[model samples]
Target chain A: MSAPFYIGYNAKMPPATAAFLRRWVVALFVAGAGVAVALAGLQHRYGDGQFEFGIVKSFDGIISESPYPNLIVRRPIGTDAKDVRSRVLLVAPGKHGAQELVRGLEGRAVTLQGSLITRDNQSMIEVRPGTIAVQAAAVAGDDGVPLGNFTLRGEIVDSKCYFGVMKPGNLKPHKACAIRCISGGCPPVLVVRDADGMAVYFVLAGSDGGAVSSDVLDKIAEPLEITGEVERQDNVLVLKAEPGTYRRLE
Target chain B: MTLAYQAISWNRQKRVYDTVMAGGVLTFLAVFVVTGLVLHSEITAEALLIRALGTGAFLLLNVVLSIGPLCRVDPRFLPMLYNRRHMGVATFLLGAAHGGFALVQFHALGDVNPLVSVLTGNTDVQRLSEFPFEWFGLFALVLLFLMAATSHDFWLANLTAPVWKALHMGVYLAYAALVLHVVLGVLQAETSPWLVGVLGLGMAWILGLHVFTGWREWCGDREHAGATADGFVEVCAVADIPENRARVVTLGGERVAVFRYDGKVSALSSVCRHQNGPLGEGCVVDGFVTCPWHGYQYLPETGASPPPFTESVPTFAVKIVMGQVWVHPRPNAPGTRVEPAKIG
Candidate 1:
């Protein structure tokens, strides 16, 4: 600092005088980057990724159909509470195949032991080839009694990311990602409003609950109306639509 | 420069310059983290850091790519170009951080190797909509790493300027990969329109500036190239060049920037020593001929960098014949103090 800062505008630096940047300036940068990497590594909080591995779990519920020819376990909300779709245990048919296992157990209480995997709070039990036991004989079950058949409008969203993983994953912006997740074997879900306009989530299944994910992959994240049999299976409410029954809405 | 080139020649100005830049980077991270916590209290530390670094790297890359054409348009932006390599290296580190975090978050603890998982996890590349977009980001990050690793002047000298320039140009391909990475990966998962908008605008701005600057320079070069008289090429009149501006002319296959300033006309090579910036586009500031790219200055008459700086460019002799200015087609050795021709 001087009384007069006599500046020379003509003082030019030689180009070869290329001063390599100061070492510590780079060191500081390297140190900063190292810290960020360390923190991320420590936060090693990993996810099961798009698909969760099949883990065995014991589930008890009455086998009933939403609209699919197959069945989902309508587990009671609690020991005494009435059953609802939110507490449904969507049953994927055992390796024995769907027809034989669900031949006459539509209304009966059944106990199945299999590997259970879940996403978006919805659970599924892939029955271990021979672990399904019928606790009660077949009776008049509420498996798609054609409570009503009408056109319903809503969106087909991948259950995994839509429910809680990512906020607003059901929108158009997530349309493509939703398609990928569903294609990867996550169960496709249809979100629609009931009489009172409450959002109800139905786990989409084939006529045999085989894999409706492939069938509806194109419909994920799209608003659509489908004509199907709306049935109440104990607590699991389902819409059973045949292939090609879903129509895309603008 | 030798094979074992010194990392950097530290100087007073460069130290301060880098210190300020480093401070800005840290400050950006702090603000990003604080805001993310306030808005998304449950957002993981890893998620916040990964996102912040990813965005920071992208923004810096845009700045790096935009600097060339920006300097072409106006020399005032040259200061940013001075330590642009540092910015590039920093961008690569940020990108690496984002990639590392993502790898740890999704691929670690699996049966397969983490890197292998990154490759195989999203093997749906055969399908258009389900292509492995994350792999594109990985590829781009690898390119960025190669760029940062070879950013030193030692590499430049060893590879030769032309080869170095071509190799660094891989950044454009890397940029394309990143665009696809974001569109297919985050755009699908995030459900946000703002990121896509910002990406679109940044791309448009960078590409538009390059096209505009290139077109203008090409047109200017072809116009009034060689109208010779005697041994000198007739350039525009002293009045044709604006005050403190230049009239560029190509003669004998050399581009000369004939500047008219302070009622005197001086000519120098159009190429800047720093990054071959167009000196003709840069105006004299405070009596020094400043490069429009990195603000490297020269004494107009001698084409010499001021004492202690040592950089220089070739000077040309200018004469005013009739009303038009003429430049001697021969170039004088760099730093030769030729007298400026007075404009009448």
Candidate 2:
């Protein structure tokens, strides 16, 4: 008998053609499943970043506006007198910094509600809108301890996203979003990894210790060598460098 | 082909094809997400969904593209081509979903409009390593949308076969953009050998299939420079074709489908008026040359669809000399009828 011909408008496919298609369709499904497993298995686990999402908690701390908004809270379990404060970076919800929220409250104690975002040792707060209230009058906070100037190589990422807003959010794939975040007032951070692949986050600041989010916009998500003065304010590190002096490393 | 266009004819075969396709897509997603959660528990739901949909769309498009060459290389694969527009439309929906999720996840909630951000987000065009790969994905998504929107026969008839075929050829361009999208985007960060190897294999498979089919077609067409007599070319013997079937011969750089049916022979343009499908590969069903790809029908003698259907292809004059079929090298205008030559 001649091979069965297939007419699509016909209600039934020829038996031979139907049988043939059944085999091929089975093979296609098997192949598709295999591809899905391979693709999913091959992905790199970028980091264990956590975004608390909607779990808002109240935090009382000294809110600083300069060099990007941050909340310096007292360590609940302080071991060393020198590290009694934990600097929790503050960002407004949705790709923005808390600068506007903390504009006039610099060095003042305040309580704010927000979700916590944490990756390794770095912590940030996605501040809830209209949640800040003055708790105490202006009080002096720690003048950052100077760590000697050093030349460091790292990739700059938006602090808001790199902390936990997104996972696998610190490389070429996340470059555009990082740029958008930084441009939209999310603080830019320089991420330097040690020889052991452990990342060290530094809040990027202009050489004179001011916000560098706008200055470092063009260099986000690229490898660069920056010669800067590093300082420790509470547990957070800040890298002070002139954006223009940063060299793009090939 | 129907005389009038409906949203969809919804035949049993089409329903089966779509069901199987949906099942395959759902299975892929279930496996990908479940396996991802097992492997990387820390992955965000949004991130997993985006990657799964994007990769799924990419793989589905690869399958959609391979179907054509697969059919050409082996006729048993014809059933896959029957409702391929269903796959095309599914691919577009998958792609649109992926793009939409990516836009919301990465670009929305930002200061600028999400659409504007997609275009202007990463101005790293100067550097190859940091090129704005999002633009490539956007380009592919737009093309897939165009193809899916016009996949129905109504558009094919209104646009004309050549114009419609040209528009659908954008699938290749979309595929190319997606290649760049994967290469410059995820691959840059993923950097896994398995990922790179699988991507290379998919590309090689597509390229190899097309090349092999093209080579076979070239070999078949090369036999055209044979003996000629009195403005006719000796194509093949009448015995070479089976009853209700055609023998395609390339004459004057055009493929002609010479059909032998009911003890008479008629020749028509081998190119189907719908999507340029090879009419010669089709069989005479109910006295009409039914396209194997989509079942678009044309009269064997006149090369025109029956009344209420306006599609037509060029016709050629044929005469049976001895037991051999001689066909004129030139073609008559589309829909022009020439009397069929008797067998004896």
Candidate 3:
């Protein structure tokens, strides 16, 4: 018998060709499933971050609107002595900071409903729309223990998403989103990692202690070396540095 | 063998082909997502979908590219080439899903428009590590869209075969762009040596298949340069061609399929009118020369499809002298009829 020839328009293929194709198709599907599992297994581990999506709770604190919008809340009765207050970062519902929400509430006592996003020691609140209630003015002090100036190397990521809005949100794949968040008034953070790969988060500020979101747009999500003064206010560590002095390490 | 364009010329083989392809795709996706969630319980839903679809499209493209060369190297692989366009369209759909999810996830909630953000997100072109890789993915998606949108036979007929073939060749460029998209974008973040090795292996497989097929064709064409006499170049002996089969010969930089069938020999242009398929690789079926790719048929003596079918290829004059087949170097206009040489 001559070799089997396939003509697609015909209702039936030659039995020999059909048998051969059936075997190959089975092999291909089996191989395809194997490749998918292998590829999935080889993926790098996802970041250990938690975004309390859709869970709202009330928080009472003093809103600060300087380098970035944040709320200062007093710690519970018995907590660590190093920091007596919890500096909770604040952001809006979307990819935006809480600047508009807390515009004139600086140094005033307020309570707001929000969802919590946290990674390690860093915490942020995505304030629900129209939920901030202004209370009586509270006494404020700008005293934070200033750590010695040191050079640190790390990548700059947007505080809102990096905290937990997105998983694995601090790399080249997430660079564009980080730029958008920072541009839209979210605080930019300098993330420095220790020798064992544990990350340390610092909210970046201008050398004169102001918001540096606009200044560090082009430098997000890259290996950058910055020499700055680190100050601890409650639980938040602020890195004061000139954006122009940030050097990109190749 | 279609006289008019239907939405599709569905057949038993095509139905079976699409079923297998769809099964493979769903199997891949199901396995990828289930395994991803099982291993990394904390991965976000959006990220999982994007990665699964993107990787699926890339692997499908590799298979799509390998089909042509596989068919060339072995005829048993010809059945896979029958409904390969369906595979191409499915690949585009998968890629579009990946791109759409990524755009919304990474760029939608931002201040600027998502499309604008994709183009202007990162401008570090001077630096290799930080170059905007989204643009590469976008470019590849556009090319795939074009190819998929015009994958039907109606567009093939309207655009003409050469133009259609040239446009579809953009798959190679799209493949290259996608390679850059993965290498520069995710690979930079996910620095796994195994991931890199798998990508490298796929590329090596595609490259090796093409090179091997091209070498085999070059050898065949070079070996059949027969002596010329009396304005006819000797192709091969009639006995050299199998019954109801063809011996492809190159003359004057053009290939001709000289077919031997039922005590006579005739030569036709090797290029199929449909998609420029290699007619020389096809076999004679039921008194008509059938294209191995899509089964487009032509008459061996006239190089034209039977009545009610308009597709045709060019014909070359052939004559037999002392058991050796000699073919004229010049080709007649497409569909031109010539006498069949009788085999003694």
Please tell me which predicted candidate would have the highest lDDT against the true structure.
2
lDDT of 2: 0.89
Question: What TM-score does model 2 achieve against the real structure?
Answer: 0.97
lDDT of 3 by residue, B1-344 (tens): 77877888887778888888888999999999999999988888888889999999999999999999988876778888888889999999999999999999888877889899888878889998899999999999999999999999899989988889899999999999999999999998888898999999999999999999989988877745678898999988898999888988888888899999989999999989888888987888899999888888999999999998888889999999999999998999999999999988
lDDT of 3: 0.89
Tens digits of lDDT, candidate 2, A67-105 = 888888887312334537788888998877787888989
Tens digit of lDDT per residue, candidate 3, span A77-189?
Answer: 12455446788888997778889999988888898999988888888899997999988875675677899798999999998888778877889999999998998889999
What is the iRMSD in Å for candidate 1? 11.0
Tell me the deviation in Å of residue A84 in model 2: 1.1
Once fitted onto the true fold, the runs of candidate 3 whose alpha carbons sit more than 4 angstroms away are: A76-83
Tens-digit lDDT string for candidate 2 (B212-303): 99899998887487579999999999999899999998999899999999999999999997888999999999999999998989999999
TM-score of each: 0.60, 0.97, 0.97
* Candidate 1 lDDT score at position B246: 78
How much is the lDDT of residue A57 in candidate 3?
Answer: 91
Which model, 2 or 3, shows the larger DockQ? 2
Please state the error at residue A181 of candidate 1 in Å. 4.8
* TM-score-sorted candidate list, best first: 2, 3, 1
